[model samples]
Target: MELKLDTISKHYKDKKAVNQVSTVLKSGVCGLLGANGSGKTTLMRMICGILTPTSGTITPDGQSIYQLGEDYRELLGYLPQDFGYYPDFTAKEFLYYMCAVKGLSLAKTKQKTAELLALVNLEEVANKKIKTFSGGMKQRLGIAQSNINDPSILILDEPTTGLDPKERVRFRNLISDISKDKIVILSTHITSDVEYIADMLVMMKQGEILLTDTPDNAAQSIVGKVWEVEVAAQELRAFEDQYMVANFHHEGERVRLRLIAESQPTENAQPLTPTLEDLYLYHFQEGGTADVSTD
Candidate 1:
């Protein structure tokens, strides 16, 4: 399914959660990346029809979500950043309950429950209470429930937050496998997730989307513009005060500063290729510039 947001805006009292944001998400995996308070959750909620936009509209498959109501919800699946699970309910029971809430017929729900448990590799633990599952297991169970109805559009917010490295890789592969014919919006601040799975990337800051492009294109935006300068530990603070440093690492007695700018800061500085983290930090930081340096 395709999701189109036309000048969608949401407000909480005097603060705007989404400010006239407009974008079209087609079938494939697209990532929404931003720091906390960047309005990603608010935007996802509006798109899922959980929270209505104060202004503008959200359309799924050519129908306005607000006008379509439950019809729109039937085609969507959303996993919020903070999801609640019943402590007393087993994984299987929880999924079955969710399927019921989604209004699926009993036979279909049973079939779907089995399919999802296998998909998430949780068939072995399906009968275990959710309170007994590890963080990663719970996350997998959450994904299973989200896909219970085989939704056409999937919106996942920080889906890999509490997972370990191994679990994260497993989850990434699962998302890639499921994204073939659906519009998947994976929201996270983990740049590596976008690097590995996103066909397109969207960067947001303070309720505004700063950039939307392919991962390669976004990384290319800062090419030849990032510099690595090795400076004395004592001088690091001074260097950071005057430049936009994307990251830094300690090496023995010195620090290697990754700075972003149009021109090199000193003779010792050497140009370095930018990563997604560099591009994201550069665009979202306070007083940061949108200028793309091709050279």
Candidate 2:
């Protein structure tokens, strides 16, 4: 099952939300990482068939999804960035309603409702109203609803918004478990969300894909470019002005800075390994360039 995008673009009155972006997605988890307003949502909407592209075509295998119509949607499950829910509906009720809407049989709906609730660990509050649930609980319920149909292509937009560290880990593990034979496109600003779970990392910037590769392979793009340096508190401002700082820590009177630069930023700078956050920060800064080195 291959999903292909051919020069897909989306434009508003005066702005181009998505450039002529083209990529082939296969059966595995593809993490869409980008800063705010980077056209991640627009691209995801187009892929889910909720929004038509200004140009280009999206096809599953060889036929356009629009042409396939219901046949295409039947195989998709999308959890939007802003998922709407009935405030009065309980977790179980919401899943049941979603299953019914997806055109499942009553027996099948019941079975899925029970299964999803447990899968997301919402069984304890299966009968609690969504209005009374916490933010994390609501997010979990939204994920549960999306999986009611057991879709082959699952699209999740910022699925870890309100989750704590523990919940985030649980959600990541869940997605990893289900992505074996499925195409999962997860869009989020959190790099850690896709750091270990995603088989492919797609980085976007200014309405265009900047890089796409495996995690280990992508980090290699900035190999020997990330540095860690300890500077006096008074030098922090100058250090930040000189490099693309990815992280900073205050250690008593000194500051530890993790930065990205073409070469060492200071005499005491030590080369360090690059992580997803380092790569993400490196690509978003002024001197960042698209270097997709998969091999």
Candidate 3:
């Protein structure tokens, strides 16, 4: 499967939510990384045909998805940041209802509901009411419901937000397994999620794409430009004032700081390789004013 966004743009009166963004995504797992309100959700919504672009077009497998209506939706599965579930319905019933809505035959819905429950590790709770399920379990059920129709493209927005560590790992592996033959777009603020499972990474800032590359490539763009310094606690404020500090922590009387600089700032500071967080910080650390030199 393939998804193409051609010069897509969205405007809200005086503010532009997405600006002439264009990219092609193929069958694999892709990560969308951005800060809150950076337009990642808006982009995903446009691609899913939930929101129309102010200008330009979106196509799935060469078909204009927006104009095609249900034909386009048939090939898509979307789990929004917040999904609703019937409070009184059992997990199995809810999934069954979703399968019906997706146009699956009765026999197919039964088979799919069982398979999805197993895939999401929610089979144990299949007969339990949704009101009794934990936050993580509900999220898993939401994912199961999204895949009822076996869509060729899957879009998950902050899918791991409320998950525990173990649940998060399970969800990550599930996503990776399901992405083998389809396109999966994961949008989240968690950097580690993309670092391990994503085949490609897309970073956005201020309604525009800041970078699109492999995780390693994105980190490499800021390589040799990050630094770590240990200074006396009293001098920490001066260092903060002089640099864009990505993060900092205290060790006894010394303060260890991670700072972004065009070049090494001090002789005592050592150059450090960049991570996804570093890349994220580099983009918005100075109120989006920091000039970044990319490869």
Model 1, residue 181: what's the lDDT?
90
Mark the regions of model 1 whose C-alpha exceeds 4 Å error after superposition. 287-295
**Model 3 regions lying over 4 Å from their true place:** 287-295
Pick the lDDT winner.
Answer: 3
**Candidate 1 pairs with clashing backbones:** none
Please give the range of 10 consecutive residues that has the lowest summed lDDT in model 3. 286-295
Question: What tens-digit string does per-residue lDDT give for candidate 1 at 18-88?
Answer: 89999999989999988877899999988887787899988887888868877777788878777899988
Residue-level lDDT of model 2, residues 236-287, one tens digit each, is 9998887888779999999999999999877889999998878887877764
Please report how far candidate 1 places residue 162 from its true position, in Å: 2.6
| Model 2, runs deviating above 4 Å | 286-295
Q: Report the error of model 2 at residue 47, Å.
A: 0.6
Q: Per-prediction TM-score, please?
A: 0.92, 0.92, 0.93
Model 1 error, position 3 (Å)? 1.3
Name the candidate that leads on TM-score.
3
Instruction: For model 1, give the RMSD to the true fold.
Output: 3.9
